[model samples]
Target: MRLPPLKALPVFEAVARTLSFSAAAEELHVTQSAVSHQIRQLEDDLGESLFERGGRRVALTEQGERYLEAIAPALAQIERASEQLRGVTDSRIRLAVPSSFAVSWLIPRLPHLQRQHPELDLDLEMLADMPLMSERLADCFITFRYRQRGYSSERLYVERLFAVCSRQYWNRVRDELDEAGLRKRGSGVTIRPEWLTRFTLLSAASVFERPGEDWRRWFAAGEAKLPADAHVQHFSHMLLAHEAARHHQGIALSNDYMLDTASDPDLIKLPTHELQTGDEFHFACKTARRNEPGIRHLSQWLVKQAEASGWKV
Candidate 1:
């Protein structure tokens, strides 16, 4: 036996669930007459009345209830199956991101998208190059850049660095260093007199350059100087540097997104006072592929998820 046209199922489902053609019309954003027409067509296809009209209200008949019970689960399953197939068959997106952002911002927020759309497959790649529209290897790229160079370069987030140290570092000398004693060290966090004499200051690699931004600026503001013979470490990626700090190796200058993104609870900020960097993290994709269905969906969903999760970068 031939079944009803598949397209009218949504119109019929909405009306049946709501028990009112007007309500379904409002939800579907269609005219009441349009909803009535589809339901009538569906009834004719099934050779029965699906709804009993009682004045303005509509109630499903026995057959209508059975049809809903049978069709609802099938329709829902079809929708999910379609997405799964889309995830596999549709275009796959390749993302190249800076190591810092991949770890501290985008990586943490990825689960939201995966949970919301399980069928969507994502491939993430990390790099340090500035994101640009003309990149050859990436469908999309996220990187920290100074300014927008073209239409595809849109600012996703702007962040600045703060002084952060390990939890061990904080607890080790919390009792000995009162607020005043700590202030004497100038920019550093307060430490006990004994701890101050021994604990060395941490410094970043000289090559890790951000214009007008560094621990030095922070030190100058507080009239402090790095302790002599303090240990210095070099890392090619900011994430690696931050990880070192999290391990209690040393304190480091870091950004809010970096701090928020770290999985290790060992790292903590020294205080609210922070150094500001005008540099911004940007999102860039090829102009042609920007509107493609998979990329578009991911772009919109990612932005919303990131904003809701509180990591602006």
Candidate 2:
């Protein structure tokens, strides 16, 4: 049996499913005219009209609907076979990761993973908020949220917060303290936690508002009290706060996962106490899809990377 041009099947399928040539073109990474030309070719080859066009909208005719029903399952089978042959059951893994983590953590390490699994593709969606845990939105999600809503998940790492500032800012503060003859205490130069009040305190407002992830909790954990009139600047996102601190704007509280030590050499970590926020990073997916070859490979790779960074699990 002869096949209706193999190339046209996908174009036809996409248009039929979306009912819009523009949408189909976008999904196929082609122009709208390209989709129209392919559809025309297919219709001419089949000697029947596949779509009923009115104004700017189009719909499948009876023949087109019947054809779709017949071809969709066959196309799926072909895709599955191709994936199986390639030893990657999922050709692409759509991952939803937090923006900060994506920028500071995952991206730096992506090259290694891509090199190892050239046949596998990763589609990353950097989201500010938690992603909807469904196949429609993403194949997997890496998040700090504890609530998984019954999804299968593996703990990746636990984040500990500490104070950080630009080296330039630290030098200026040290010089001022030295000029005032207040830099040394006991046997060495020391800056008290209260000294932080002297500088503008840059903070992520949302993180501070979270139960155990606040400046008050961090200060308390360090056996210090936050000054009542601490100079402060608030940011909604930690990435911005970190950047602010990097630029010598102020001191910012940073967590382990959000700071790339190698990338920002000028950022100096303040020798202050650390506080565990009780939040664990995790990779989550639908329970049934956990064992898929692509998901399993990615999960194992991520775990290995996390373990290399001193995370226990």
Candidate 3:
């Protein structure tokens, strides 16, 4: 049997997702009229009105919802197949990863990936959470997972987190702590985690399930009690927290893979202890396509990069 207007499926999906013809048009880079035309054509082909339209608002009818559920995955798979075929001519691996990882880790080392595999081109899609393999939005995914599932996932690193701040800020804080008159020995001033309460703790919620939790754990690990009035500045992602710390705003918890102490002279790791969050960052792909040449090579290259970047686990 012939399929309903295959070209219109994407337009329908986009419109259904956004619930606005104009929004879908903008996303598809088409005029609003074109989006409506495509939806109309699709509805005609399917012999069903997929959307309930009323005065600038659009809602998916029951049929529309069911249709979307069935077609969305198929569309995704078809797109992946097309990309795979194109990848034969040009080795392209579409990668999805957390935005923080992209900014702090992957983007910096991308030149190295290009030099090592001149043929491979990485198209990174930034997301806050891991994409499901079935979504087929990307050829590969990098995620921090609690445990390994049956998918073709390779453990890239067991995350090691450390408290870090700009050298200038750290120095200033140290001076303040010293003036407060407590731990001072020889050339180096001793640090107690309890002193962290004095300055703003930059909390990146993405690192843990909740904001400020990492700081609490970090302090606890150092045998220091969290002060009742401990100040915390919250951010949604590590990149934001890192930015604040770089500007001497506050101290932030940083991931080992993302934190380059040798290369980044401005940001210094605190003398305090590290937190082993048990968070595992994995490079994974759909098991069905795990052995695909591009994915396999990409995975190997990433694993090497992770190891070289001090991912001990």
Candidate 4:
């Protein structure tokens, strides 16, 4: 037996299951008129009225009910088969993450996760900012300072802010300042708090300017005062600032979560300052999706990694 246009089946199923053209359209991300058009086309092809339309609502007709029963299982089987062929189960996770977090944290750990759960597939959407929970853009979101009422959330890490510079930049500054009449203590050279103003400050314009997470706050926390007029280069994102610091363009205020102090020999954290912003990283998703196998597994893995790294949960 040949199939009537396969595209219309999903439209029909959505409309039949919901019994509302508008609801089906919303679920299918189309207009109600488009749903009606597809249904009309399907009905013409089958030579039957699939729905009984009332004043405002709709109900599946007897033929429609039978058609739904027959096709729903077939569609489900096709979906399952497609997933299987793609080497995944019904548990694929669509995760939305901040671009900086994805690059600094999640991407590094992805290889280990893939090794552990080869059957799972993760689709990552990187956004500059956290999306509203109501948008439902992805199955889960990993972000900083995100809180929503209807969704379930788990803390991943608390952020500690500090200044970071390339080792080459630090050495160049130290030598320059020492030659320029700055005192050197014994074998080790000391950089004064005010000396930070000498270098071009790379600021995360968006991230730090969010209320309490600013250069002023960091300076206060470190007991260092900024000069009235300090030369600063601003970037909209922390990732960009980090890159600038890495390339020796300037010193960047960095969060502990992104900087690997032990392994990264090129970047060095400047002494005498750390700011605890009370804000934390979190993994969140709709409560309904909390129990899905892929979500559960990924959430657990994230929590484990956080704990292993000694980050606050």
Per-candidate RMSD, Å = 19.4, 9.7, 5.0, 10.2
lDDT of 2 by residue, 1-313 (tens): 9778889988998888778999889989999999999999999999999999998899999999888767765675577677789896466889989888988889999999999877778999877676335443467899876365447888998878888889899777776666667666333444667766777888786675652246777778878887777877878888888899999998888987776566668797776778887788899876766898888899999988888777645
The lDDT of model 3 is 0.81
Best by TM-score: 3
How displaced is residue 12 in candidate 4, in Å? 20
lDDT of 4 at 178: 71
The number of residue pairs in model 4 that clash at the backbone is 0
Residue 1 CA displacement from its true place in model 1, Å: 58
Candidate 1, residues 1-313: lDDT per residue as tens digits?
6768787888878887667899789988999999999998888888988899999978889898777766765665565468677774655677778776787778777887788767667888777555223222356777564243322655666666666778887665454454435544334654322233344345444214642235556655455554445445555556666777778776677876777644557788766455556576666665545686777777788677557656556
| Segments of candidate 3 deviating more than 4 angstroms | 1-77, 80-90, 146-150, 185-190
Arranged by TM-score with the best first, the candidates are 3, 4, 2, 1
Of 2 and 3, the candidate ahead on TM-score is 3
TM-score of each: 0.57, 0.67, 0.73, 0.68
**Each model's backbone clash number:** 1, 0, 0, 0
Clashing pairs in 2: none
Candidate 2 TM-score versus the reference: 0.67
TM match of model 3 to true structure: 0.73
Let me know the TM-score candidate 4 reaches against the reference structure. 0.68
Candidate 4 lDDT over 229-265, as tens digits, reads: 8887878778888899999998888886688887788
User: How high is the lDDT of residue 84 in model 1?
Assistant: 71
Worst 10 residues of 2 by lDDT: 182-191
Tens digits of per-residue lDDT, candidate 3, 120-224, equal 878998876753343445667888742333357888888878889999998888788777886563346547788778899998887777987878888888888
Report the poorest 10 consecutive residues by lDDT, candidate 1. 191-200
